[model samples]
Target: MAKPGSSGDEQLPSNEERGCEGIRSRLPLTTLELFFVSVIFGMFSITLLCIYITMPSVDQKFLKIPRTVEELRTLTEYVSKYTDSYKPQVLAGFCVTYIFMQTFMIPGTIVMSLLAGSLFGIAEGAALVIFTATAGASSCYFLSKLIGRPLAMWLWPDKLRFFTREVAKRRDYLFNYMLFLRVTPTLPNTFINVCSPIVGVPYLTFLVATMLGLLPATFVTVRAGVALNTLRSFNELYDVKTVGALFVIGFVSIMPAIMSKFQSQDSDRSHSS
Candidate 1:
């Protein structure tokens, strides 16, 4: 046995210490990465500024990010008036805003989806939401590829590990696994957007999964937007039935992976026999 003060008795670094060390080791690269992120933010800001400058004059009071049902209704009323006259401008602004929110992992996209439905009706709104959401998710995936490692490690170490392990186990069926994640509440979309690249999910897989898997949920929200005036609360958006439907969709998405796993198990058992 080692003596109490011997080097052999020294404990290995705890997870927290190791994490800090890893972060410190990447400090220089992290600084450069963050500079790039800031540059991207600046470019988006300028684009939004240009869109705003070109947009037709409207009451500034109605020009706010709707955080509540009442706010959404009010903005919907005012923006609808301008949408018809300035459809292209309105669409551009909406897409830019939605994409910016997603790329930065900002919240309130549900509100944006509702607004889309309110302005564009169900079919167009769903399509718009899907396109912008996919674009945003894609943007985030690439951004994460640049600087996501330390941030993911810092913000969600345990979740990152779990995601990485799951991803490794389902490499053969990665598309299905990713689709399931997008369809279900198993992981938050924002989290998925930020950590997907960090966990080694490919851009093509991420893009397709996001576009298709988000359809069901996006449709629900957009449909609700058409009747935004009637919504008493956000809780009404994802009631039990809706949540169950989403889960069913999620299960369907993963069915292929599940079948493959069972088939492999049976094959192994047969070989053993």
Candidate 2:
């Protein structure tokens, strides 16, 4: 029953086999990966619970995460009442909550930054935001290092490949490139945080870039928080002018790298000639 020019044992896969393979490919993680995720989630939960238990008594309704300007104002008003008496508790809770959101790639950190401004003014608020953002980004980087390859590949195969290739081309100028990314909105921070370690970006470079690169944006958000009572919308925080300024800063950060790249090319041409 062997077909001409075919081995007797050779056969096309059945439809069921093909379907199973497709299903496996579509799965985002394996059992072990899920286990790792659960462990990290559990640790974060415990830390948050501890922070909550130590906090002073307050109406539970006012203790939710703020998603909008109005909601942020409400929570800020309520929390401000206690900051004087519970300064340490307030700072601890805020830092923990901010870090929690960042570590898990959650949104609403903008609102948290606003809250920092509302509570601590520009100087302290910017410092707090930068510190917590770096810590959170670092946490995400390490977590991704452990179990992010599959998830990143599944979610962003093209982006992952592109980032890896770009990083490869700029190993000598890695810090400048990274700082540019952080300063500009060229890529999502969450994507950068998760993919950096996967692409072999060292922790020091990631750490320093995150701290310094976040400064300008952090100052803008925190300053807006100072005028929280007059603030209308999130869009007001980042207009065209602000965005252009950020881009300019980002460009300046990478200028040295660009100049070096050009110099290297010229040197290569001279040698070839």
Candidate 3:
């Protein structure tokens, strides 16, 4: 039996009410958002597709871990030939080509950095490497932001999973973490640049971290460049000794936080007094 004026139903929302609720419930998406997202992801797709079609042997031919010193030497020499002159035309051409090399996942970046050192001297070489690496990294970050998570994951499956997990734990010290990633050999820095955006790292954080984080590696490669002939293998760029030195630097990088912690503790005690 129904009570008077009681349908005994979940209060059926009016059509108008339902329509409004539907608008509220569903996520709002504008054409502009879709267009921007499409453009971004489309760029990544295009880059990937182009690479896949043209460079099917990519992982083997190019990205295969360069284990031997001869491979590194051969590569440095090839690039060095083009860098024979310090003319503006050659420099511009090198920048443009290197930018593409980095953005498109082409290999030999370290050799390229080393070449800069051999040609430009230590200070200028380091500056060039840091500048170029940052620019290239920023380009990848923007592309990932546009492509969103899906494409980023597709392109860098294993690396993204590890990076996302790590970034989550150190969200508070993002700059330090970014520095660690760039300074150490754990993550290929170019990979980090592209994936960070997909994992939601901010642009400023990426920029500053990139600019500062790449310094040590740049210095090491540049120093090695001073004696480029001695560097037979790519590993020579940053061997165990260099890695140990960098870890010490990473430890020093965390010192400011230790000091800040002590300062806060002292302030807390004073306030209790």
Cα lDDT of all candidates, in order?
0.85, 0.84, 0.65
Q: Per-residue lDDT for 26-88 in model 3, tens only?
A: 434457666875675576556545544542232335433234556655555554554554345
Total backbone clashes of candidate 1, pairs 3 or more residues apart or in separate chains: 0
lDDT of 3: 0.65
Q: Work out the TM-score per prediction.
A: 0.89, 0.88, 0.66
Backbone clash total for model 2 is 0
Point out the worst 10-residue segment of candidate 3 by lDDT.
7-16
Best by TM-score: 1
Candidate 3, residue 29: the lDDT equals: 42
Local error of candidate 2 at residue 107 (angstroms): 0.8
Please provide, for model 2 over 88-188, each residue's C-alpha lDDT reduced to its tens digit, 9 standing for 90 to 100. 88898888888888878898888999999999999999999998999999999999888877677667666766777677777789999999999999999
lDDT, model 2, position 32: 90
TM-score of model 1 relative to the true fold? 0.89
Better of 1 and 2 by lDDT: 1
lDDT by residue (150-247, candidate 1, tens digit) is 67667766776677667776778999999999998889998999888766677899999999999999999999999988898988999999999999
Candidate ranking under lDDT, highest first, comes to: 1, 2, 3
